[model samples]
Target: MVLTNVEEQMSLRLAVEDFLFEESALLDDGRFREWLDLVTEDVRYVIPVQTTRERAHGSAGSTTMAHWDDDYIGLEMRILRLDTEYAWAEDPPSRLRHFVSNVRVRPGSEPDEYEVRSNVMVSRGRGDSRATDLLTAERQDVLRRTDQGFRLARRTVVLDHVVIATHNLAFFF
Candidate 1:
């Protein structure tokens, strides 16, 4: 059966949402290795530093400083560190729950690519702690269509809070 333009768009949107949900699940389940497969070899993942500024000024996120600005190699190194016994920060491993919402998908500048914007709220709980730290952010991503599926090409995470309350950022977003 042939599909109309709208139908095709709807299908693509659903696929993007599914991809994001699956990625979140992988992170929540602490399956970093599996998650790595979802990104392209030259993927650029960044989380810019957020600050409070006056209304007259520009955006709150700074262009210079970043909490995380990593390429595929850097990401792989982080995952490798997590796998070792010496990575004391994540020795116990935090329980995580990633909630993705408000997904908007549109055509990217490049062919076979989609620009996706979404809101994410991550709940993280550490050892013997009933209290859960919440991290909320808006993510802009570029997903490229491939034979396997849609793979993350680029991602820029803008956090809601200027001051992070969490002990450590050992988990992926």
Candidate 2:
């Protein structure tokens, strides 16, 4: 069984859409554990800070002014924080909606992997919270096709808002 370039492209394109939708739903549903399963053990999820310098170009450095640069462990800790006795940030829990679209799959330089990019828009609301529309940035994800399925190895999130005005991020992107 094999596929031509067109078929592969179509399949991967749909897969990316499905993946984004599924992940978004998972986060909205508060299925953190399940979301964790979607990522590889060596996953990297970063939300790099974008300065107010421009309308598009954000900070590239992960350490520059990033509000978050999380690995698996860090992600897990976030979940734990939410479950804490007094996690003020999420005491009432914020409702989030992740809108992902315009996924473009670039030609894979590696035979077993793909370099994918997409645009994300997240809107969140909570009691007494200003209903922050977060730095909906672009993401560059490196997805690897495995025997099981497509697994995320790396994800770099370049936020549109370099300076986050909201509370701490306890949610998964």
Candidate 3:
């Protein structure tokens, strides 16, 4: 059966949502290597540092320094390190729940690509700790359709808080 443009778009949206859900599940499950596979070889994962200034200062985020600026190779190394026993920050490993919502997907300028924006809240519980660290942010992603499936080509995370409350970033956003 032939699908209309609207129908096709709806299907695409559903596909994108499913892709995000799967990615989140992988991270929450501590499947870092598998999660890295979802990213393209030339993927760029960036988390810009946020600042607070008067209204006259204009934008709050700065390009000078990024909390995280990783290419595929860098990301792969990080994932590999996290999986090793030497990684003290996650040696015991923390329980993480990634909540992704407000997902909005639009066709990108590039062919077979989509620009997606979503709100993410990561709740992490350390071993025997009564407290849970909550990190909130908005992520802008570029997803490209590949032979395997949709792969993340770029991700820009904009954290909500000016001063991050978490002691350390042991979990993915």
Which numbered prediction scores highest in TM-score against the true structure?
1
Cα deviation of 105, candidate 3, in Å = 0.8
How many angstroms is residue 55 displaced in model 3 relative to the true structure, after the best TM-score fit? Answer: 2.8
Best by lDDT: 1
Residue 152, model 1, lDDT? 97
Per-residue lDDT for 1-173 in model 1, tens only? Answer: 23359989899889999999999999999999999999999899999999999979989999999999999999999999999998898879989999999999988988888899999999998889889999999999999999999999999999998999998777788
How big is the positional error of residue 46 in model 3, measured in Å on the Cα after superposition?
0.5
Model 3 C-alpha lDDT per residue in residues 1-173, reported as the tens digit of each score: 23369988788889999999999999999999999999999999999899997999898898898888999999988888986788898878989999999998888878878899999999998889899988999999999999999999999999998898877775677
Ranking by lDDT: 1, 3, 2
Per-residue lDDT of candidate 2, residues 54-93 (tens digit):
5366534446656677888988888777787777877787
Ranking by TM-score: 1, 3, 2
Candidate 2 clash pair list: 50-162
Error of 1 at 27 (Å): 0.6
Q: Provide the clashing-pair count of each candidate structure.
A: 0, 1, 0
Q: How close is candidate 3 to the true structure, as a TM-score?
A: 0.94
Q: RMSD per prediction, one decimal? A: 2.4, 3.3, 2.5
Kindly state the number of residue pairs that clash in model 1: 0
